[model samples]
Target: MLRVHSENELQLNADVLVIGGGPAAAWAAWAAASQGVKVIVVDKGFLGTSGAAAASGNGIMAPTPENWDKVLSERYCLGKNLANLRWLERVIEKTWLSLPLVEDWGYRFPKENGESVRQSYYGLEYMRVLRKTLLRLGVQILDQSPALELLLADDGSVAGARGVQRQKHCTYTVRASAVVMANGGCAFLSKALGCNTNTGDGLLMAVEAGGELSSMEASNHYAISTAFNATVTRGVPFGWASYTDEAGNDLGGYINGRRDPSFLPNALLKGSVYARLDRATPEVKAVIERSHFIAFLPYKKAGIDPYTERVPVTLVLEGTVRGTGGIRIVNDSCATKVPGLYAAGDAASREFLSGLASGGGGPNAAWAISTGQWAGVGAAAFAKSLGASAHERVVYPVGQAGLRSQSNTVETFDSEEIVRGVQAQMFPLEKNYWRCEQGLLDSLASLETLWQQVQANPKQDTVSDVEFSRRAAALTAVARWAYFSALHRTETRSEHIRVDYPETDPNQRYYQATGGLDKLWVRRDWIKDAMSGDKPQNVKVVTGAIDISGKDVGAQGIAPLPRLSGHAQLISGDV
Candidate 1:
């Protein structure tokens, strides 16, 4: 029960424009506002409760020195020699600093008698606290404003963004000196718990504006419920619970009696997986209840007692969150090669992990908070450097067609068809958790067809239809990015399990896919062995002219995103 702010006025002439309302975007707004910079945060939904940020069953990964060492070691082992160690070390350092700020903002981690309490993940309380903090600091939030596309400057830097406002059928642009792309990772491609707003807005917008993305391969099935379509309270499965098949066989035995992201999904090939808490000791149940109180409500509503019957589950497809991948920022300052453009949280953190793997939950949340601050502060400094030149640049010239509210028009594109089509195909048994070259190629072909529909269909002459068209095209792009990257990565590793390339090959090592989906490229080899400034070879190249260079609102046409420059650098620093 967080009190989300009502819809806000269209705030313009901003120093920074953060595109999401989740924790990372909120944190970015807080940092920028503290610097006396004009900041505005817009979202597809409400400020505090939007996206997976407000979801239950997530805990802060505190940077205790011992846990830090263990977590890094495990993640690196998964990343092989290709891990970006520097960025992770930075996250560990900044997370502790951030917690105190959260506490000062009237947020609290569970504690007992002056001692800190450990949680598997912070639940709803975290989102409420973050929203409270942003409002207290006088940060402006435009909820229900779904950003349709990034507005680029003459020099190819991000000038701002354009999106349609809910209720009012008007498209608006907020001008800014610097832009922070912090929308949470893409979801709903598979039936999962992430907000509907997480349709890869940040990823698609960034790549469209010439930013690079990695770990798209990680955008596979994550935290899927073993019981298909059964509503579980928390989308992520708790590690402490016992997992069993329909026949009451132990699932954890397959993975050394521990919670595993990959092995658990693989076990779903058995009869439906179910989790039970009936056998846990009273002490353990207390902890589970405290961290996951919301999870119990679903079982209660179903007229089942968790102390007796096990709940059924199935996999939910949250490509960005579960895959731990997103828009790749090149520098430690959180700036992409596109200059004023910046990315944080799930959008940029996956750059530090190999395309083949992802760090688990605690680390993922930690990255969101830390990188949010990093991008915010860095953006502030960059804007300050612009000095006289940092004046707000407007993207939409006066009087765009969709600006006026209209009535009674026929819908041209079936948006529901596009959304449902992606979710159904992305999670099919042959492709989602399990994969091979042919299956991936088929998925890519289907996604391409969706994009074709986006292009061929004429936009209706109404305001709402215009907004719908932009969103449909954007979501289609999101799926295309996921499938194309997944198809490009040849070897199997971590959550990206491919039946064809069943084993992790030493030859493939750290080669990762990057660049725009229009013209995709995988790095020549594992980045670990490269010298101080050695250039990377382009493994595969497809060149289609990418023409997204429009500043006016009329640029929303669904062209195959301009072919990437083909020279956009892939993973470099902090390895």
Candidate 2:
């Protein structure tokens, strides 16, 4: 079924299609190919050099049977009873097994006492080995191809996807029996090193196809980084580093010899903040230099020693890239509510493991490896079940609002402005990190206005235009979902801190479910019922409709949102 329709279009067919160019996408393709099915991977960048995993070192949460009980207990407790123990147990086991496989495939783990260390990995080298192994498996890889939207079969299952080939200046369409979405998460264009391209593209495409998002309120994650630098946000070195305010006053943030995660952001709310690693021992300094040599390069160029000099520090908004929010997976197979479609890694919510808290670093890396394998296996099995009639189904493209305008007439709008507007709402620490009822409402109203602008614009004329517009729409949609979910939770829990509702409410023990484009809805779903595959009752919050001209259509007073029996939707007057 592979065809060259013209010089501008390339059509392809595969048993399984994996979207993304990260560690999760690589593992998914590997797993699918292991099932003896034809698999294709499409990435926005090169396979081995894209995504957050490729630009950072990560320590994996791999536990053996001996320590599994202790590790699982601690991690589950960290989630404050929202993390699912079953999923945590599965992640530990899968991660343990998967790491050794990587070593067997020629990745050399750090050794100690004549035994290979399996605790961590260097992102760049790890991905290179993985890319090599995948090529050996006969998996076809498509680089620099970013999928704009998903296609659906006549029966409403995901059929395949279509995207622009940036390097080729054309378009490519793939028809497949099953698809895996592992394209990572949105960072609101924060430029956090490797996360520039992680703009919730998969999340938006999935939602447009009737998929739902869970725990999006947990998407607010900020990492402490040196001023004017996006790389090297590693917190270990900061453990011994001391923080000071503009007047050189101590912040009293040293807790158990490590700085609290909230210390920097809280200090930043007032004025400038700076850090000094003067307390780091020689051993710590050596580790920092060896592990983060790239980060120190700029410092060396500027003739500044971070160990001795005062370095200004700022928190970078990581958004969903480090947060535990994304497309809701319905089962252990990482399958979404839409059949034949699966999601993994940052593209799928990790709430089953991290709940309302952030699951960046170790927990996220483990979840990526485990869920990627599960999704791939599930997709392959589904594809195999289709037998020879897989390609016979009638399919339609489901992309809208990005590839084409939601409105009939093509309208002129600045996509970059839309992206910047989203950043203004999401990237600020005071607006997103600290939550107040009025602040949430204001941010939501602004996001709604931006969303309307996106909906009115038409498809672009070039590949870059299409990608830019799509990223803008995707980021705006993600911010809206996060704010809506945050608005509904009401209670302060884990990473979701509501200043108005400062205390944790025992009654709010459910997850918030959000979906819909024109009619954005947020509903509370009982965790137990959701886990058991039963439909849970919905508790809603009213966010009155806002018009496209940035006017409040039916703005309600600053009163407590009543717990409505039915769903509460945030609609736009333009829509």
How many clashes show up in model 2? 0
TM-score of each: 0.82, 0.91
Error of 1 at 446 (Å): 1.3
- Against the reference, the lDDT scores of all candidates come to 0.64, 0.82
Q: Write the per-residue lDDT of candidate 1 for residues 50-121, one digit (tens) a residue.
A: 767576667666657767877666665666545656655677778866777776766666678986654344
Candidate 2 positional error at 490, Å: 0.7
* Candidate 1 ranges with C-alpha deviation above 4 Å: 1-11, 118-122, 189-191, 226-271, 353-355, 388-411, 458-464, 517-526, 529-575
Candidate 2 regions exceeding 4 Å error are 1-6, 255-258, 529-575
Q: Compared with the true structure, what per-residue lDDT tens digits does model 2 show for residues 31-58?
A: 9999999999999999999988888688
Best by lDDT: 2
